[model samples]
Target: DIALAFPNQPRAAVGEVVTKAVERSAPTAQCTAVEVWLLAGGVLGMAEEVGAETKDEGPAKKKQKTTTDMTSARLRHIMLKFQDGAPKTPDGKKVRSKAEAETLMRKIMRDLNEEAKELKSKHRGRKPEDYALKSERFTKLCKEHSECPSAQKGGAMCGDLGWVSKDMQSKRGGNFRELVAALRPGDYSDIVTSMEGLHLLQRIA
Candidate 1:
């Protein structure tokens, strides 16, 4: 409205595509609405003032309902175990500090993303080998930089713990399942620390 009010102004150039993420709910589906803050009385007599305090507080409870969302997930990780008495791989990476571990993990991530982009450009469609190629790339990175023995098989692709469940526990002892719960498929967490040292975990499946 401000820009339209001054039609002759040179500052009226606004051309951009913006994408917004909204909650998946009835209002989002049919109402196709977005909420905004209002002034004390009105904005140029646009409408009466409205705020979250006066909005319907009904569905807020529905969000807390329990579910049988227990499902198995697949994950691949590049572990950078610091030499601070954390669990060691067969060939312990002599990372001496959290900073060192994070640096290595970020390097691996950089390499992984570059290769992934190249692969997508090369096979730019829904090909049969899409998942295989992507996961294989992650596997290769796992093989290269990961301190875990799973790196031996390209980030534990064939390891016994293939599709892990929410209730499952790690033999090395950590809230591994909790970590899994924090991610959706194709999402990776920031550097997480436990007795297992610094981790860069991604849920591929």
Candidate 2:
């Protein structure tokens, strides 16, 4: 149950994707498709002083009907007691903020670099443990934003990480860092290193 708003793509392309989504819906779940701004109108009309005048304009272009569907997924509970600040771990320890998280990530990266150098010196193979550490540190932001206890901590509120420039814009997938960049800042994403496979990611904002 999702209403994905696609910008900059042709309406036909979106409609095709929606049709696929609807067809793939579970038996118990219903789905609908809509084409946005699908309308027809003639050229701009002009009025006459005598009465009403109609100018002979060319054929009317179809209106752009932005289609959106409604589904059953909705939040119902409204908790009056809300707390601010970063969430705590399961042991009730304070978690790190975004800035702190980034700093810690950099430290982790540095440590990993040193560890990789050591491993290369000791043996001529890559370190699985080091790769795991890198993925874990990179994905920490996503996890905290997902299951963290803090109320105000979640969401894509991260202002900027200088990931994307103004010129580049597309929804294509890339490496772990690029995936995070594709989203608005503070959106949760994961970095999973496998032999070679798609990375597991979850949006928390």
Candidate 3:
């Protein structure tokens, strides 16, 4: 486990160090997993700053303030992705253009929403086993179509991300975090653009 001080260092840098530490320790310690705990607000503090600034604004500014507020709310979500079909970008990097990524993500969200409705209808009042089966099916669907960064992990499709506090910075990025925070539990969000790609998120609690 790694205990990281809040407002201490960039998350990406910390993650790199953790990855290297694990790799180095693997030879003798056989490290399998690592956990990180943040000590302070870190990026979450930035969100507070935005909120403070909005407090004295006029009505027009209030509208803009609402946007900022939405961006910093806390949330937990299941994130799925739809990768750009193209194999490479103009720079020869293996990434999709923003437009292409958004289009694909929207399509995937539509499909997932329909499936969610069906699952709810079929299992809403059923036995625990029935609900478990529905959950399994949803997991399978996430695994089959998701292109999320963590999707490569076996049996990790649409995996729960746990509770994210408002203004927190996650591996999913700030925009993604804010998007999730804005949604109600059990709600499906529209396409969210992130550095990793485009995402279709479901807030599950």
Candidate 4:
């Protein structure tokens, strides 16, 4: 998050090499990713089609080309973090052990699964849109379980993650953007284990 806010610049390190320091103002490790961009340029492996505007060729031989139009999505998530030697949460508190964090994440997932089954049976003959599992259930659980600061807003509508380009996400870790892309709209992801924490992702779009 800090890296996104302060992109294209060198960042300070957070520590007490001098000793007796509390090591406040954690420096972002992500700042080094600029070096990768300087080398590979972007999301190296795949090609993303950027639509080009139609143009006229000769006089009456005007031609047109249309690439696939890109679209965006809305997403929300619940995260359970442990004190893994990383920094504290946005609220400036440390989490418990990893085992405890995983336990809580599983419990939340189980509850969500139950809700999905119930909703399925109850609305069998109705339109999918009317009964599809979506944000509300997850939002309720998120407030109670997620440690992410966005929890206060129930993960917020757009996740407050803003626009992330393929190039940007390539340098970022946690495989978060990839996992999120796999989910269907209105569907929640399985428990995701990453360096940051365990998470449940819900695609609102």
Best prediction by lDDT: 4
Q: What's the true lDDT of residue 110 in model 4?
A: 56
Give all TM-scores, in the order shown: 0.48, 0.22, 0.45, 0.50
Colliding residue pairs in candidate 4: none
Regions more than 4 Å wrong, model 2 = 1-95, 125-205
lDDT of 3 by residue, 83-181 (tens): 556686678977655544444444454455456546656665542223322444446545665665444444423444445555454565736765555
- Predicted candidate 1 versus true structure: per-residue lDDT over 80-190, tens digit per residue: 777645565569754366655655665565555455445545565533133433545567666666677776763336222367666553543465655556554444444
How many clashes does each candidate structure show, in the order listed? Answer: 0, 10, 0, 0
Runs of candidate 3 exceeding 4 Å displacement? 1-95, 124-137, 153-158, 169-174
Better of 1 and 2 by TM-score: 1
RMSD of 1: 17.6
- Superposition error at 169 for model 3 (Å): 4.3
As a whole number from 0 to 100, the lDDT of residue 111 in candidate 1 is 53
Question: Lowest lDDT 10-mer window, candidate 4?
Answer: 38-47
- Please give the distance, in angstroms, between residue 118's alpha carbon in candidate 1 and its true position after superposition: 3.0
Task: Give the top-scoring candidate (TM-score).
Answer: 4
Q: Is candidate 2 or candidate 4 better by TM-score?
A: 4
Per residue, candidate 4 scores C-alpha lDDT tens digits across 1-205 of 3222111111110111111132332553222222211111011101111222335532433222211122444556778877756676799876577656655665576566567656656666543334443435666887777777777763344233444444543444576666555444445554555666777665544
